[model samples]
Target chain A: MDRVAVIGASMTKFGQRESWVMDLLAEAGEACLDDAGVAPDEVEHLYVSNMASGEFEGQTGIMNALAHDLDAMPAYSQRVDQTSSSGGAGIYAAWQSVASGASEMTLLVGGEKMTHQTTGEATDVIASITHPVEYKHGVTLPSFAGLTARHYLERYDAPRESLAKVAVKNHRNGLDNPHAQFRKEVDVETVMESPIVADPLRLYDFCPITDGSAALMFCPESVAEQYTDDYAVVTGVAGATDTQVVHEREDPTVMGGVVDSGEQAFEMAGLEPEDVDVAELHDMFTILEFLQMEGLGFAEPGRAWERVEAGETEMDGELPINTSGGLKSKGHPLGASGVAQGYEIYAQLVGEAGDRQVDADVGLACNVGGFGNCVITTIMEAAE
Target chain B: MDRVAVIGASMTKFGQRESWVMDLLAEAGEACLDDAGVAPDEVEHLYVSNMASGEFEGQTGIMNALAHDLDAMPAYSQRVDQTSSSGGAGIYAAWQSVASGASEMTLLVGGEKMTHQTTGEATDVIASITHPVEYKHGVTLPSFAGLTARHYLERYDAPRESLAKVAVKNHRNGLDNPHAQFRKEVDVETVMESPIVADPLRLYDFCPITDGSAALMFCPESVAEQYTDDYAVVTGVAGATDTQVVHEREDPTVMGGVVDSGEQAFEMAGLEPEDVDVAELHDMFTILEFLQMEGLGFAEPGRAWERVEAGETEMDGELPINTSGGLKSKGHPLGASGVAQGYEIYAQLVGEAGDRQVDADVGLACNVGGFGNCVITTIMEAAE
Candidate 1:
C-alpha cells in the first residue's frame, strides 16, 4: 500500500478572534495551500472537521461555503465531525481519500468559532455530546474530569500536584509557540492556587474554550516530492470508540479508545513508544495528558505521573511531549485542537518547528473526543 | 484494486415517527447488520450521516453514541455531513474505508428526526445551509424553487403540466414502497389544483419535512460473498461542488454539481448514461427532478421535461427512475434521503426491492445538497 504524506500545514492564532468560523477556516486553508505552493484547483478533495457551526454560528454547510471561498469549485467537500477529535478524524479521512485513489490531493481543515458565546453557552454546546442518561443528571464535562481525576489519584496514590505540574509544563512549552492562546508561563504553585472549577481540579486544569482554525494538505507519498522537499509521511493512523456512558467504564483512569487506537496505530507503523521521538497528547484537561501517556504506552499504568514528576516529558528531557503546548496552554478550539496537534507534529518532523524544534525523526498525536468516547492516534515520520 | 460491494441494506419507515434521531439511526443500523448476518463486533468502522442532531435534538457525538448503542464498540466511527447530501457522503466514506483497506467491514447509517417540530421550525433548521448573504435577504428555499421552476419552464418552453406529472408519477411509485412515508397516489389534476407555494410550484411540488433513517453495509468484494450471496458492486462514486452563491452561475437552469459529479462517476464506471438501467434522482423539489435528469445526461439539455411527459421515466419505461418514490413521495428527511436513495438502488440491483423491484442490472443515485451547492453521484452494478 502507498503511504500518505503531509505536504504542508497551517495554524491560526488559537484564541478569541474577530473572524467567523468561515473566515478562520479560509485563513488556515489559504495559508496551507500557499505554504505547499499548490493551487486551489489542485485540491481534489476537501474535508472540514467542525463540531457545530449551526449551534455556534447558526451556520451549516460551511464546508461547501469554504470550497466556494477558496475558489476550489468542483472539488468534492464534506464535513467530518467527531466532536473534539474531529481534526484527527479528518486526518484519517484525508488519508483514506488518497490511499483509496478517491483523490490525489486532499485538503483537511478543522476549525470552530466558540468564544463569541458566553462561557456557559459554549460549555453547554460542548456538553451536548455527553450521554443524555448521564447529562440529564446534571453531569458536565468538567465534573467528569474532576471525578475521574479524584478516582485516579486515590486509586493510584498519586498526588494532586502531579496534575498541576502538567499545566505548568505545557504552559512553559507554550511560551515559545506564537500561535498558542496563552503564552505566559505558570508555576505549579500558581496552578494549585487557582480557583476551583471542580473539586480538586482548578480553573488552570481545564483547557479554555477557544476559537481558532488549522489546516493540513495531504497527498499520496509517491507524488509528494514534486510538491516540496520538507514533508512528513503518515506512517500510521487509527481511530476507535469507547462506551458512551462514561460511568460504565470499569477503570476510570484507563481510556480504552486511546489504548486501542494507539496500539493499532503503532502496529500499522511498525513502531513502538520508544520509536516516537516526540509526541502530542490531547491535554484538554491536565490529567488527560497523563492518561494518554499511559494509554499510548509511553509509560506503565499509574507511572505516567512519575514520568511527569521526573520531567521526562519536558523539553530537552528523555521524551518531550506537547511541544505545541497542547490544549493545555495552546487552547482547545474543539475541532482545531487535533489538527493543530498534527500541525505541530508535522512541523517537528519536517524540521519547520523553529525554536520548539527537537531531534526527532518520528512523532505521534493522540486526539480524544467526548471524554474518551472516541479517539484517533496518528504516527508520522519525516519523509526519507 | 479490489472493488467495494454492498452486502446488505435497510431503511426505516420514512415518515412522521415518534422516535428520536438516535432511535431512528439505531433502528436502521441494527436491521442492516441483521440482514447481512454480520455481528456488531465484525463492523470495523461505523459512520453516521446526520445534518442537525444538535440543532434539532440538542444532541452531539451521535456517531460515538451509535457505536455504543449497537454494541459496535471499538469500531472507528465518525459523522459525515454535507447537509441533505450527508447520506451520499456517508456511502463514499464507507466505500473509502473499505477501498483504502482502513476497514474490512464498514457500516453506514443516515438519519434525521424533524417532524416533532412545527413545519416552520423544521424549515428554519433546514435553511441554515443557505448562504448567509442570500438568506439575509428574506429568501427561503421554497422561493428559490419557485424562481428556478419559473426560469426552467420559460427557457425550455415546457408546460406546467410536465412539473405536475413528476409529482403524480412519484406518488404512484410510492404506493409500492412499504417503508415510504406517503403511499396515497396523486394525479396530475390534484397536483395542479394543490395550494400554490412558490407561484409556478404548489404544495405537492415540495416534499414534506420527514423523519427517517437508512443504512448500508459495505465490504471488499473479496469478502462480500462470505456475508451474502445477493450483493451489489459499487462501480463508481464521485462528488462535486458548485458555487455556493446560487445566482452566480451563468446558466441558472443547469445544476453544475449534478453535471460534474455525474460525468465523473460515469467516467469512473466506464459506462454511459445509456448503461444506467435505473436511477434515483434527488427530487427535493419537483423541478429538481427535471434538472438532475438533464444534468446527469439522461436527456439532452432542456429536454428532461419532454422525457417525463413521454412517460420514458416510468417504472415500465425505458428508464425506471425513483422506484422507491424518489424523496418527493418517500419523504425528504435531509440526511437520510441520500442514503435511502442508495438503499433503493442497492435493493434493485440485488433483486431485494420487494414490490418496488425493477428489472435492472445497473443503477445510479444522485444526491444534491443545499441549493445545488454540493452533489454526489454513485453508480452500482449487480454482482455477478
Candidate 2:
C-alpha cells in the first residue's frame, strides 16, 4: 500500500468571522492549494468535514458549492460527518483516496458556521448527536464532561487545581497562535474563580462556541517530491466507536473509542506513545485533556492529572501537547477543530510552526466526538 | 490495488414505515449480515449514507447509534452525505475502505426517514441543497427537472409521451418487486393525465417521498469466496460534481456529473456501456432517466427518448433497466434510493432477482444528487 503525505495545510483565524461556512472553507482551501503549489485542477477529490450546515445555516450541498467555489470543477466531492471528529474522519478519507489509488491529489477542508446562532440553538444542534434517551434528559456534552470531571476528581483524589492548569496552559499557548480565538492568558486562580456552568467544570474549563475552517492537502508519498521537499507522511490513521449511550460504559473516566483508535494508530505506525515527541489531544473540556492523556497511553489510567500538575505536557516538556492551543483556547469549531489539530501536528513535524515550534519528528493527534462516542487517532512522521 | 467485491445486499420495504431512521438502518444492516452469514463483530468499517437525519428527526450521531444498535462496536463508522446520492457516495467510501486496505470488511447502510414529515417540509429540506440564489427564486430539484425536461423535449423534438413511458415501464417493473413502494401499474395515459407539477412534468413524473433503508457488504475479491460464491465484483466506481447552481450548467439536459462520473467508471472497469447487460438509473424525475441514459453513453446524446419509445429499456429489452423498479416506482427514500439501485444491479448480476430475473452478467448503477449537482456511477460483474 502506498503511504499518504501531507503536502500542504492551512487554517483560518479560529474566531468568529464574517464569512459563511462556504467562504471560510474556500479561504482555507485556496490557501492550502497555494501552500502546496498545487492547482485546483490537479485536485482529484475534495472532501468537506462538517457536522450540521443544514441545521445550523439551513444550507446543504456545501461540498458541491465548495467545489464550485474552489474552481475545482468536476472533482469528486463528499461531506464527511462524524460529529465533532469530522475533520479527523476527513483525514482518514483523504488518506484512503490516495492510498487506494483512486486519487492522486486529495484536498480536505473542514469548517463550521456557528456564531450566527444563539448558544442555546447551537447546543441543541450539537446535543442531537447524543443518545435520544440521554438527550431527553437534557444531557448535553458539557453536562457529560461535568459528570466525568466530578467522577475523576473523587475517584483519583486529584486536586481541582490540576484541572485549572489545563485551561491556563492552553491559554498561554493560544497567546502564540495568531489564529486562536482566545489569546489572553489566564491563571489557575482565575479559572478556579470563574462561575461554574457544569458543576465542578467552570466556564473557563470549556471551549468556546467558535466559527472557523481548516484544510490539508494529501497525495501519495511517491509524488511528494513534485510538491515540496519538506512534507509529513501520515504513518497511521484509525477511527473507532463506543457505545452511543455514554452511561453504558463500565468506566466513565476511560474513553473506549480513544483507547481503541489510539492503539490501532500506534500499532499501524509501529510506534508507541512514548515515541511521540509532540501531541495534540482533544481538549474540549479540561477534564477531557486528562482522560485523553490516559486513554492514549500517555499516562497511567488515573495519573494524567499528576502529569499536568508537573508541567509534563507543557510546550517545553518531554512530550509537548496542544502546541496550537487546541480546542480549549484555539476554539472548537465542531468540524474544523480536528483538522486544526492535524494542521498543528503537521506544522510542528515540518518545522513550520513559527513561534510555537516544537522539536518533533513524530507527532500524534486524537480527536473525540460526542463525549468519546467516536474517536480518531492519526500519527504522522517527518519525511526522512 | 485489490478488487472490491459485494458479498451481501439487502433493502427494507420501500414505503412509509413506522420505524425510525436507526431502526430502518438496523433492519437492512442485520438482514445484509444475515444474508452474508457474517457476524456483526466481523464488520470493520460501517458507513452510513444519510442526507438529513438531523433535519428530519433531530437526531445526530446516527452512525454511532447504528454501530451500537448492530452490535458492531469498535467498528469505524462515518456518515457520507451527498444529498440524494448519499448512498452512491457511501458505496464509493466503502470501496475505498477495502481498496485502500483500511478495512477487511465494510458495511454500507443508506437510509432516510422523511415520510413522517409533511411533503412541503421534506421538499424544503431537500431544496436546501440547491444554491441559495436559485433557491431564493423557488428553484427546487423538481423545478429543475421540469425545466430540463421541457428543454430536452423541445430540442430533441421528442414526444412528451416518451417521458410518460418511463413512469409506465418502471411501474410495470415495480409490479415484480415485492418491496417496491408502488406495486400497482400505471399506464402512459394515467401519467400524462396526472396533475401538473412544475409545468410539462406531472405529479407521476416525480418519485414519491419514502422511508426505508438499504445495505451492502463489500470486501476484497480474494476473500469474498469465504462468505459467498455468488458475489459480484465492483469493477468500477467513481463520483463527480457539477455546478451547484443549475443555471450555470453549460446545457440543462447534459447533466455534467453523470457524464463525468460515468466516463470515469467505465474507464476504471475497462468496459464500455455495451458491456452492461442490466442497469439502474436514477429516476427521481422521469426526465432524469432520459438524461442518465444518454449521459451514461447507453444512447446517443438526444436519442435516449427514442430508445425508451422503442421498448429497448424494458425488462426483457436489449439492456434491461431498473429490473427492481427505478426510484420512479421503488420510492425515493433520499439516501436509500441509490443503494437500492445498487441492490437491484447486484441481484440481477448474481442471478438472484427471483421474479424479475434478467440474464445479466454485468450491471451498472447511476445515482444523481440534487439537480445533477453530484453523481456516482458504479459498474459490477458477476464473479465467474
Candidate 3:
C-alpha cells in the first residue's frame, strides 16, 4: 500500500455557534487547505461528513453546499455519515482513494449543527442513535450506558467515584482547551450531584450536543514530501461494528468492534498499546471512556476505571488520554467528533497543541458511532 | 492490489415490501450466504450500504441491526452511505477491506426502504439528493435531468424519440429480469403520452421509488479459492465526485466523475471502454443514459442516443446497456441501485442472466449519488 499521510488539519470552535454549519465547514476547510499549502484545485476530491443537516437545519446535499460555500467548484464531493465516526470514515475513505492511486490529494470535512433545533428535539433526534427496536422500547443511549454502568458496579465492585473521576479529569482538561465545549473544571462532588439523565449516569457524564466542524487534508506520502517534515502518517485505519440492539449481545459490556478494530489496526501498524504516546478514545458518555480504554488494549477488563482514578490517564501522568478533553469536554458534535479526534492527534504529534500539548510521537484515536455498531480506530505517527 | 472476487450475490425482489428494511437485508444476506455455501460465521466483516433509513424507517444504527439480524455476533460491521452510490461504495469498501488485508472475507449489502412514506414525503426525502441551495430553490433530481436532457437535445439534435427508444429497450430487457420493478414494455407513443413530472422528463422516463436490498459476499482471491470457481473478479474499481451543485458545472451534459472514474478504473484494469462487453450505467432519468455513455467513453457526445436507437445497446448489440433494466426498470431503491447494478454484472459474467444474458467476458457498473456529486464505477470479469 502506498503511504498515506495527513498533511493539514483544523477545526472550528466546537460549541454552540452563531454561524451556519456550511460556513463553519468552509472555514475549517479553508484553514486545512491553507495549512496544507495546496490550491483549491489541487484538492482533487472531497469527502463531507455531516450526520443530520436535513434534520438539524433542513439542509440536504451538504457536500454540495460546502463545495459551493467554499467556491471550490468542479471538485468531486461525497457526503458520508457513519454516525459519530463519520469524520474518521471520511478520512479513511480519502486515505484509501489516495493510497489506491485514484487521487493524490483529497479533503475530508465533517460538521454538525445541533443548535438549530431545540435541545429537546435535538435529544430526540440524537436518540435515533440507539437501535430502533431497543430505543422504541424505552432505551435511549444514556439509558444503555446507565445499564452498563450499573452492571460494571455490580460485576467488579467498581467504585461509583471512579466514574466521577473521568468527568472531573475531562473537565479539568477542558479548562485549558479553548475549543472545548465546557472549558471549566468540575469536582467529583459536583459530578455526583448533577441531574440524572439516566440512573448511574448523571448529566455531567454525558457529552454535550454541539455545533462544530473539522477538516483534514490528505495526500500520498510522495506529495506530502513536498510539504514540511512528515508529522502525521495515517499508519492504520480499521472500522468495525457490533450489535445495534444491546439485548442481542450476550454481554453488552463486550464492545467487540472496539477490540477487533483496535487489534486489527494495531497489528497492521505493527505496534502495541504500550507504543502509543497519547490516546483519544470516544467518551460520548463517561462510562464509554472507561469501556473504550479497555477495548483499545490500554487496560484489562474492569481496570480502566482504576487507571483513571489513579491519575495514570492525567495530562502529565503515565499515559495522557483525551488531553483535549475528549467528547465529554471537547464536545460531541456527532459527525465531527471522529474527525476532531484526528485533529487533536495531528496537533499533538506536530507540537502545535498549545497549553494542552502532549509530548508524543505516536497517537491513536478511537471514535464510536451509535452504540457500538460502528467503531473506527486509527493510528498516526509523526512523519519520518 | 490483491485480486478481489464476488463469491456470492443475492437481491430481494424490486418492489414494495411488507417486511422491515433490516429483515429485507437479512433475507438477501441469507440468500447470498446460502449461495456462497458459507455460514454467517465465515464472514470476517460487513459493509452495509443504506441511505435515508432515518427518514424512511426512523432507524439510524443500520449496521448493528443487520449484524444482529444475520445472527453474526461479535462480527465487525460498518454502515456506508454515499448518496445513491451507497451500494457501489459498500462494494468498494468491502473490496478494499479484503484487498488491503483487513479481512479475508467481507459481506457487502446495500438496501433502502423508501415506500414507507407517502409519495409527497418520499419526494421530499429523495429531493435531498439534489444540492441544498439548488434544491431549496425548487431544483430536484428530475429537474436536474430535465436540464441535461434539454441541453442534449439542443446540442446534439438527438431526437426525443431516442428517449422512448431507451425506455423500450430497457423495459424489454426487464422482461427477462425477474428482479426488475417494471417488466412491461411500452412503445414510443406510450412514453410520449406519459405524465410529465418535470419539463422534458415524463413519468415513464424516470425510475420508481423502490424498497429492496442487494447483497454480495466477496473474498480476496487467496481465500476466494476456498469458496467457488464461478465467481466475479472485481478487476477494477474507481470513484470520483463532481461539482456538488449541478448548476455550477461548466456543462450540464458533462459528468466529470464518470469520465475521471472510468478512465482511472480502466487504466488500473489495463482495459478500455471497447474491452467492456456489457455496461450498466445509472439511468435514473432517460437522458442520464446518454450523458453517462459519453462520459464513460463508450461513445462521443450526442452519439449515445444514436447508438441506443440503432440497437447498439441491445443485449446482442455492440455494447449492451442496462440488461437488468437498470434503475429505470429494476427500480431505484437509492442505496441498493449501485449494488444491484453489480449483481447484474455478476449474473451476466457467470452466464446466469437467463433470457437477457449478454455473452460477455467483461462488464462494468457505474453508480452516481445525488446529482452526480459522487460516482463509483467498477469493472468485473468471469472469475479465474
Candidate 4:
C-alpha cells in the first residue's frame, strides 16, 4: 500500500472574519494549492470537512461550490462531517483517497462561519450534536467540561490553578501565531480572575466561537518529489467513537475514543509517545487538554496536571504542544479547528513555523468532537 | 488491489414513517448486519450518508448516535454528504475503507426524515444547494428538470408523453417492490393528465418527498465469502462533479457529471454498457431518466426517448432499467434513494429480488445530486 503525503498547507486568519463559509473555504483552498505549486486542474478529488453550512449560513452544497470556485471541475467532491472533528476526518478521507488509488491528488478544505450568529444561537447549533436526553437537561458542551474539570481537580489532588495554566501557556504560544485569534499573552492571574461562564471553568478557559478556514493538499508519497521537497508523509491516521451519551463512558476523566484512536495511530506509525517531538491537541476547553494528554499516553493518568505545572508542554519544553495556539487561543471554528491543527503540524515539519519553530521531526495531532463522542489522531513525519 | 464486495443489504419501508432520522437509520443498519450475519463488534467503520439531519430534524452528530444505537461502539463513524448522491458517496467511501486496508468490515446507512415538514419547507431546504443567482429567481431542482425537459423535447423532436412513460413504467415496476412508497401502477395517460408542477412536467413527473432509510454492508472480496456465499462485488465505482451553476454547462440537455462518472466506472470494470444486464438510473424526475440513459451510453445522444418508446428498457427488454422502480416510484428520500438503487442491483445480482427478479449477472447504478451538480456510478457483478 502507498502512503499519503501532505505537500502543502494554508489557513485563513482565525478571527471574526467578514467572509462567509464558502469564501473562507475558497481562500484557504486556493492558497493551499499555490503553496503546493499544483494547479487546480490537477486536483482529482476535493473534500470539505464542515459540520454545518446549512445551519450556519443557510447554504448547502458548499463542497460543490468550492470545487467550482477552485476551478477543479470534474474532480469528485464530498462533505465529511464528524462534528468538530470533521477536519481530522477530512485528513483521514484524503489519505484513503490516495491509499486506495481513487485520486492522484486530493485537496481538503475545512471551515465554518459562526460569528454572524449570536453566541446563544451558535451554542444551540453546536449543542444539537449532544444526545437529546442530555440536551433536554440543558447540559451543553461547556457544562460537561465544567463538571469534568471540577471532578478532575478533586480526584487528582490538582489545584484549580492548573487549568488556568493551560490557557496561559496556549495564549503565550498564540503570540507567535500570526493567524491566531488571540495573540496577546496572558498570565495565570488574568485567567484566574476571568469572568465565570461554567463554574469551575472561567470565560478564558473556553475557546471562543470564531469564523475561519484551513486547507491541505494531499497526494501519494511516491508523487511527493514531483510536487516539492518540503513535504510531510502521514505515517498514521485513525478515528474512533466512544459513546454518544457522554454519561455512558466507564471513566469521565478519560476519553475512550482518544485512547483507542491514539493507540491505533501509534501502532501504525511504529512509534511511541516519546518519539514525538511536537504535538497539537484539541484544546476546545482547558480541561480537554489535560484529558487528551493523559488519553494519548503523553502523561500518566491523573498526572498531566503536574506536567503542565512543570512547564513540560511549553514551546521550549521537552514535548512542545499546541504550537499553533490550538483551539484555546487560535479560536475554535468548529470544522476548521482540526484542519488548522494539521496546518500547524505541517508548517512545523517543513520548517516554516517562523517564531514558533521547534526541534521536530515527527509530530502528532489529536482532534476531539462532541465531548469525545468521536476522535481522530494523525501522525506525520518530515519526508525522508 | 482487492475488490470491494456487498455482502448484505436492507431498507426500511419507503414512505412517511413514524420514526425520526436516527431511528430510521438504526432500523436499516441493524437489519443489514443481521442480513450479513455479522456481529456489530466486527464493524471497523460506520458511515452515514445523510444530506440534512440537522436541517430537517434539528439533529447533528447522527453518525455517533447511530453507532451507539446499533451497538457498534468504537467503530469509526463519519457522515458523507454529496447532496442527494450521498448514498452513492457512502458506497465509494466504504469501498475505499476496505481497499485501503483501513477497515476489515464497514457498514453504510443512508437515510432521511423529511415528511414531518411541509412540502414548502422541504423544498426550501433542498433548494439551499442551488446557486444563489438561480435560487433567488425561484429555481428549484424540479424547475431545472422542467426546463431541461422542455429543451430536450424540442431539441430531439420527442413527444412530451415520452417523459410521462418513464413514470408509468417505473410505477408498474414498483408494483412488485413490497417496500416501495407507491405500489399501484399508473398509465401514461394518468401521468400526462396530472397537475402541472413546472410547465411540461406534471406531479407524476417528479418523485415524492419521502421519509425512509437504506443500508449495505461492505468488506474486501477475500472475506466476503466467509460472510455470505451470495454476494455482489463492486467491480468498479467512481464519482464526478460538474459546474455548481446548472446553466453553465455546454449542453443544457447533457449532464457532464453523469457522462464522466459513468465512463470512469465502466472503464474500471472493463465492460461496456451493452454488457450490463440490469441497471438503476436516478429518475428523480421523469426527464432525468432520459438524460441518464443518453449520458451513460445506453443510447445515442438525443435518442434515449426512442428506447423508452420502444419498451427497450423494460424488465423483459434488452436492458432492464429500474427493476426496483427507480426513484420516480420507489420514492426519493434524498439520501436513501441512491442506496435503494444499490439494494435493487444487489438483489438482482444475487437472484433474491423475488417478484422483481430478472436474468442478470452485471448491474449498474447511477446516482445524481442536485441538477447533475455531482454524480456517482457503480458497477456490481455476481461473485464467482
lDDT winner, 3 or 4: 4
> Which regions of candidate 4 are displaced past 4 Å?
none
Give fnat for candidate 3.
Answer: 0.49
- Tens digits of lDDT, candidate 2, B1-384: 568999999999999999999999999999999988889999999999999999999999999999999999999999999999999999999999999999999999999999999999999999999999999998898888888899999999999999999999999999999989999999999999999998899999999999999999999998898877899999999999999978978888899999999999999999999999999999999999899999999999999999999999998899888888889889999889889988998898888899999999999999999988899999999998
Each prediction's Cα lDDT score?
Answer: 0.94, 0.94, 0.83, 0.94
Worst 10 residues of 3 chain A by lDDT: A67-76
* Candidate 1 residue spans exceeding 4 A from truth: none
**Across residues B86-193, which tens digit of lDDT does each residue of candidate 1 receive?**
999999999999999999999999999999999888888888888898889967888889999999999889999999999988999999999889999999999999
- For model 1, what is the alpha-carbon lDDT of residue B285? 92
Q: What share of the true interface contacts does candidate 2 keep?
A: 0.90
Error of model 4, residue A252, in angstroms: 0.4
Model 3 residue-pair collision total: 4
C-alpha TM-scores of all predictions = 0.99, 0.99, 0.95, 1.00
Score candidate 2 by TM-score against the native.
0.99
Please count the clashing residue pairs in each candidate, in the order shown: 0, 0, 4, 0
Every model's TM-score on chain B: 0.99, 0.99, 0.98, 0.99
Query: What lDDT score goes with residue B8 in model 4?
Result: 96
Q: Which stretches of candidate 2 lie over 4 Å from their true place?
A: none
- Deviation in Å, model 2, residue A164 alpha carbon: 0.5
lDDT of 1 by residue, A1-384 (tens): 678999999999999999999999999999999998899999999999999999999999998999999999999999999999999999999999999999999999999999999999998899999999888998988999999899889888999999998999999999999999999999989999999998889999999989999999999988898988889999999999999999998899999999999999999999999999999999999889989999999999998999999999998888899999889899998889889999999999989899999999999999999999999999999988
Instruction: Give the distance in Å from residue B19's predicted Cα in candidate 2 to where it truly belongs.
Output: 1.3
The candidate, 1 or 3, that scores higher on lDDT is: 1
